[model samples]
Structure formats: C-alpha cells, structure tokens
Target: NSILGFQGNRDLALNMINWLSSDEDLISIRPKDPADNRITLSRAQMQGLFYTSVILMPLAIVLAGVSVWWRRR
Candidate 1:
C-alpha cells in the first residue's frame, strides 16, 4: 500500500502479493534501479534561467505585440 509514487510501484506490489501468497519463486525477481540523473545549477545560472524564461520572454512577447500593433495602426 505504501509503494505509491515509486518507479517500481507495480513490481513492488506484485512482490508483496507474491510474498503474502507464499509464492517464493515469484517473489525472487527484483525491481531495476531507478536512474539518478540530476542537474546541479549554480545560483547565477538559476537566476539567469529564471529571468530569461519568466521576465525577458514575456517582456519580449509583449513588446513584439505592441510594435506590431503600432505598425499596423
């Protein structure tokens, strides 16, 4: 019941069910290791990404829209 959110939730549940049913052979199989691929961002890098995506991007989009509107008028 506590295997929720795990990568091998199904396998874990199956193993637990097998163990409970005394199916030792079925419970012999083990789940594969989940990959650990993480990115470590520096403070500067984090700030740069935040500004670029959150601020600069929306500002650029708005400016472009306003410019187009002005040109059209």
Candidate 2:
C-alpha cells in the first residue's frame, strides 16, 4: 500500500502520505533529513571499533576502579 526507496526515502514517504490524503497542504515542509543512514566500515576500522568497545572500554573501566581503590587506600 505504501512506497519505499533506498535513497532520499524520507521525501518519498511524506509525498506518499500527502497523496493518500489528497491534500497538498498536509505538509508544508519536507521531513527533516534522516540521520546518517549508512554504516560503512573498512576492515581496519571495524577491527578497531570492535577492540575499543569489546576490550579497551572494559579495560579502561577496570583501570579506573583500581585507581580509585588505590587512592582510597
């Protein structure tokens, strides 16, 4: 019943609704640009992101906890 497109899909959606309503004034402005909709990663970047999230973040937290405990002692 609705339409779909990959690029600039948001504009198509608002236009579709206006068409269905048969009222041109249903929307005076186009919808805001969608968020950066694509997620692209190179192999190195992917590995780095994975390590940062899965390893470095937890390591940093542990280090911070140790530092706090050491300071208290």
Candidate 3:
C-alpha cells in the first residue's frame, strides 16, 4: 500500500512539474479546455505537505533555538 501510494504520488508530482514547467498558454490549461495542460494532486499529496510542515516547522524552530542557546553559552 505504501509503495503504491509513493508511486502514485511520484507520478502526480511529475505531472504537476511537467504542467508547471510547460510553455503552453495559460487559457489553454483551464478545466473546460480539451488539452492535457493541467495536472492534479491527490489527497495524499495535500496531506503529505501538511504533515511535512507540521513536522519540519517545529524541528526547524527547535534547531534554531538550540543554535541560539549554543551561541549564548
């Protein structure tokens, strides 16, 4: 399950990057359009980002606090 989720996410991320980096026109990428110019992210992607922020932000704050404490020591 985890591996499948990872592969699905990897594919989604790749598609997003491809769409974002493409040189196609903006209006051509709308939902009503016929071109495949838009990429979609799954709920896992959203949750992954949220979880990453939740974990990393506090870790960064702790690291910064430690750095300040060490400097003052």
Q: Which candidate gets the maximum TM-score versus the true structure?
A: 1
Which stretches of candidate 1 lie above 4 Å from their native place? 1-33
Which candidate do you rate higher for lDDT, 1 or 2?
1
Looking at model 2, residue 50 earns an lDDT score of: 96
TM-score of each: 0.53, 0.52, 0.38
Candidate 3 Cα RMSD (Å): 15.3
- For candidate 3, lDDT tens digit of each residue in 1-73? 3663443565555567667888334323323336677757799997888877998888999999999999999
**lDDT per prediction?**
0.87, 0.81, 0.68
Residue pairs with backbone overlap in model 2: none
Worst 10 residues of 3 by lDDT: 24-33
Sequence-dependent TM-score of model 2: 0.52
Evaluate residue 1 in candidate 1 and report its C-alpha lDDT on the 0 to 100 scale.
Answer: 55
* Model 1 agreement with the true structure over 1-73: per-residue lDDT tens digits: 5656577777778889998999878975575778899999999999999999999999999999999999999
Judge candidate 2 at residue 16 and give its lDDT. Answer: 79
